[model samples]
Target: MLNVLVTGGNGQLGCEIREVAPEFADKLRLFFVTRENLNLESESEIETFISANQIQAIVNTAAYTAVDLAEKEPEKARSSNVVIPKLLAKIANRHKIKMLHVSTDFAFDGKSGKPYKEDDLTSPISIYGKTKEEGEREVLKELPKAIILRTSWVYSKYGNNFLKTIRRLGKERPELKIIYDQIGTPTWARDLARVILKMIQTKDLSGFYHYSNEGIASWYDFAKEILDLSNLKTKILPIETSEYPTPATRPTYSVLNKKKIKQTLEIEIPHWKDSLKVCLSELD
Candidate 1:
């Protein structure tokens, strides 16, 4: 059996991986570690764990995901997103193990009129995005074979995401104003988790790739669908991004092109709406 180590065991993608891990139990031996159990920021600790367990592969899901909060805490963001990935890449290279790192679409400036491909130029606008972009660079530099999976607008039943936020607020508020201009696809974390597990098991699979649900939607559109799925009566008013200004500027259009991953893995991607329905059902 292939021994695999999954960091960030408590986050959305990590939690989803845990939920679906039993399906792959026959072929994979998965060990999960969160901040409570493993100090990911500590280099010696990570190195020791990987060596002690003889880990064959690693799925690095840990990240500093607070977008707006990152603006004020750039040091913390760099520590989590940059330094940790760099360290992990170095260790994985030494251990000669496969590594898959999760990244975000915010790596782009969102000025592209078309969907972003794996090779597109990245011009990050915020601290979080910049740090993520830097982290990707570090991983690639340290281990060129490491897989960098970039995704957008991730949500799940386990974490604080747009879907959960809208669901909670839609229940309490009569009306919610959501940004409609900024557009991207909503990715269910469970889908991404499954894809990562599959990728880890497949050998000689490395480099940059993109994955998200097939369809696109703005924040307002996503919120509307969530409220509808939850059977909530809260009215959602569509507003421009300027109307609801945030500390970190979001991409006006950050939809990722999934053609590379689709063709490479031959995996079918569910539409955002369809996956949203399934996720809402799980939440219920």
Candidate 2:
């Protein structure tokens, strides 16, 4: 079996990968490492692990994802979001290991009226976005073969996400207010994990691609769907982004263009609602 090293083993994406890994057992031997076990900063540690496991591939799910908090603590975010990926990319390249690095839609300012393409100009408005963009640059420079997947509005049953948070809040509150101004697709981590496995199995090496669920929605729309599907009685109110200010400014539209991934990979993507239902069903 080919050994694959997955970072951020404790995160939602990482956890989802673990859940789906059994299906790929015949081809892959995945070593999911949480931060406690795998320190990304130390080169010696990364090298030691890669050498010990004879890791042939690396799936870098680890990243600093707190958008608002990143604005306040740019240094910590930079180290985790930018430096860690860069270091890992360099190591992966040195060892000639296949690498897949996850990025976010925040890399865009959401200025594009249409969905964002892989070649679109990146103008990050927040520190988190800037750091993530920089990380992408470093990884590409160091390891051109590395597959970089940029995703948006990811939620999963495994970790603390919008769906989980809204479920809890709806149980407690009769009404919920969600931002209607910001629009994007809500990506389910399970779907993403499955796609990553496909990429690994097929040995598809597209340099840059955007992966998110089909269709578009605002935060308010997403909230209503969540409550409706979960059979919660909470009433949802539509509010503008101005009403809910955060340290990091979100894009008014960050929908990723899926044509590249769809065309290149020849894979079918599930509709956001269909995948949402499956996730909710699993959650129950």
Candidate 3:
């Protein structure tokens, strides 16, 4: 059986993997480990764990995802986003194991008018984005066979994401204010997990790739869609980015160009709105 070690087992993507791993029970041996079991902060510990286990592949989903908080605590974010992944990449290279690393759309500055491609010049505005970009570079330099999948606006019922936040706020408040300037695709974590599994099954799939649901929507549009789908009696107010101040400066247009991944992997990607409905139904 092919042994696969998944880090960040409690995360949104990781939870989806846990649910789907049963299908590959006969051919794959999956081991899910949370931060407590395998601390990324301790490089020695991480090296020992990978060396001891006969792990054939690794899916790293652990990251310091707080964009705003990363501004204040850059060191903490660097450790989780950059340091840990670098260590893992080195170990994976030595073991000749396939490593899949998850990244964010924030790695781009959002200055480009069109969808950001895999080869686009990255100029991150926030600390979180900078650190994630650093992590990607380190991984590529260490493990050429590793796959870095960059996704945007990720949400799910299992984790704390934009969907859950809007749902909770819509229930508690009468009106919600969301930024209308920022445009991107809302990626369902489960769908992304499925894509990852499909990529693993395919032969010779590696390097940096972009993966997000099809169609683009601003934050306001997404909020309205969520409320409409959930049958909530909440009103959504569209506002500019200036209205609601945040520590981190988000990209105005972060939609990624996913043509490369789709063409290379020969996989069909679902539309953002369609996947949102499926996720909502699952939540219900």
Candidate 4:
């Protein structure tokens, strides 16, 4: 069996990957390690684990995902987003192991107001975005064959995510004011995990690719659907980005175009709302 090491073991993506690992048991042996245990800061630790386990492929889902806090704690973001990936790439390359690195759509400035493609110019506006973009570039520099997957608005039943926050707020608060101006697709962690598994199994596709649930939605639309599906009575108010000020400047539009990934994988992608319903059902 091919040894697959998954970083960010306790994260939503990592947990989701574990949920899907059983399906591929015949081909892969997955080892999921949390960031604390993995300790990307210690090169010796990483090297020891990879070498000892004879890890062939690494799925790096670990990242500094706190967009707002990243501004205040830029150094922390840099270490996790930039330093960790760079170190992983260097180690993975030396060991001749395939690496799959997860990135964010925040890499782009969203000035185009369209679904972003792999070749499009990146102009990150926030510290988090900047670090993640740099991480992607640095990882590719070390491992040219490494797969950099850019996904957006990720949520899942596990971990602290938008969907869970929405559900909780919907139950606690009578109303919510969500940003309607910024548009993007909400990607399910489970779907992304499955995609990663497919990529590992196929090994035919590589490089940068966008993966998110098909279709577009603003934060307001997303919240409305969440409440509507959950039978919550929360009144969702649609507001512009200016209505609610955030520490980090988000992309006005960061809907990722799935044409390349869908065509390459030759698999049908589920619509955002459909996936949302499924997730909500599972959550219930």
Candidate 5:
């Protein structure tokens, strides 16, 4: 069996990976580590962990994802998104092991009227996006064979995500206003987790790829779907981006085209509405 180390063990994606690990038990022995368990800041510590566990692959999912907070803490964001990926890539290269790094669709400025493809040029507008983009470059510089997966609007039953937040607010308030200007796909963490596992098994699969649940929706549509699925009586009101301001500027449109990954993996992706239903069912 291949020994695989998964970072961000407590995050939504990591949790979903943990849930589905048993299905790949015959081929993969997955080791999950959170910051509490592993000192990611120290290179020696990560090197020692890899050597000790005989790890053959590394999935780096731990990232400084506090988008608005990142603006105030650029250094911290750089450390997590850029420095850490470079360190892991360096170590993985030394060990000649497979590595998969997760990234965000915010890498783009979102001015692209069309869906972004794998080769689209990235012009990040926020500190969080810039750091993530830099991290992708750092990994590629260290380990040319490492795979990078960029996804958008990730949510799960675990963690404080949009879906969960909507569910909570919908229960407490009868009326809610959400952003309708920004658009992207809502990716189920479970779906992304399954795709990651598949990529791990595919030989010579390395480079940047995009993955998200099929179809697209604005935040308002996403919130409406969640309330509808949960049978909540909350009324959702659509508002423009100007109405709700954040420290970080979000792309008006950040939908990623999944044709490359779909063709490469030969798998059909689930639509956002369908995946939303599946994820909501799990929450029930």
Candidate 6:
């Protein structure tokens, strides 16, 4: 059976992948490794672990995702976001194992005024983006067969994401201010996990692909939809990105064009609002 190794097993996306792995059943042997078992920052540890397990395919969901905190901890971010993947790619190449690296839409500067295509030039605005972009390049360079999937605004019922944040804040506070100027698609971690599994099933799938829900919405609209679906009484106020200060600068429009991934993978994507409903339903 094909053995699959997934990193960041405890994270939002990683947990969803673990939950769905059983559905694949006898087709693949799945192993979920948390940070303690597979220290990403330690190349020797990762190499030792992979060599011992004889992992066939690596699904790298590990990343430094704390955007604000990344500004203060650039080295840690680089180690997790850049160095780890570079090491994995080298090891995967040596072992002839397939690698799938998860990336973000933050790789772009958001100056294009339209949805970013796969081949568009990347100009990262934050340290987190820079590190992630570096990870993508390093993986592709080391293992040409590796697949790099860039997603945006990932959330789920499981972890610390925007959906849960809004849910918690909506209940605790009477009003919330979300940015109206920023526009992007909200990708449910569950949905993305399913797509990644499908991609793995296809042996010919490789290269950079953008995976996000079909439609786009501003943060304000997204928050409002979340409130409406949850039947929350919180008032969501729209404000500019400037009104809300964060440690890292974010793209005003980081929507990704999914045409290449859709055609190449022969998969259908759900709309943003539809995914939001499905995710919210699980919270009940």
Ranking by lDDT: 5, 1, 4, 2, 6, 3
Clashes of 3: 0
- True lDDT of residue 145, candidate 2: 89
Local accuracy of candidate 4 as per-residue lDDT tens digits, 90-133? 99999998999999999999999778999999999999999999
Q: Per-candidate TM vs. native?
A: 0.99, 0.98, 0.96, 0.98, 0.99, 0.97
User: Largest lDDT belongs to which candidate?
Assistant: 5
**In candidate 6, what are the lDDT values of residues 1-284, reduced to their tens digit?**
77888998999999999878888876877889888876776768877877777778999999999998999999999999999899889989988889899999999999999999989999999999999999999999999999999999999888799999998999999999999999999999998998888777778888889999999999999899999999999988999988889999999999999999888877889999998998888898
Cα lDDT of all candidates, in order? 0.94, 0.92, 0.90, 0.93, 0.95, 0.91
Model 5 bad stretches (over 4 Å): none
Error of 1 at 39 (Å): 1.4
Local accuracy of candidate 2 as per-residue lDDT tens digits, 1-284: 77999999999999999999999999999999988997889999999999998999999999888889988999999998889999999999999988899998999999898999999999999999999999999999999988889999999998788999999999999989999999999999999998887776566484889999999999898989999999999988999899988989989999999998998789889999999999999888
Off by over 4 Å in 1: none
Worst 10 residues of 5 by lDDT: 194-203
Q: Worst lDDT window (10 residues) for model 6?
A: 37-46
Question: Residue by residue across 1-284, what tens digits does model 1's lDDT show?
Answer: 89999989999999999998998998889999998988887889998898899899989999999999999999999999999999899999999999999999999999997999999999999999999999999999999999999999999999899999998898889999999999999999989999999999987899999999998899999999999889999988999988888899888999999999999999999999999999999889
lDDT (Cα, tens digit) per residue for candidate 3, span 74-159: 99999989998988898889888889999989999999979999999989999999999999999999998889999999998887
The weakest ten consecutive residues by lDDT in model 1 span 38-47
Q: What would the TM-score be for candidate 3 when compared with the true structure?
A: 0.96
Q: How far is candidate 4 from the true structure (C-alpha RMSD, Å)?
A: 0.9
Model 1 RMSD in Å is 0.8
Q: Please give, for residues 1-284, the per-residue lDDT of candidate 5 as tens digits.
A: 88999999999999999989988999999999999999888989998999999999999999999999999999999999999999999999999999999999999999997889989999999999999999999999999999999999999998889999999999999899999999999999999999999898789999999999999999999999999989999988999999999999989999999999999999999999999998888889
Which ranges in model 4 have alpha carbons more than 4 Å from their true place?
A: none
lDDT of 2 at 263: 85
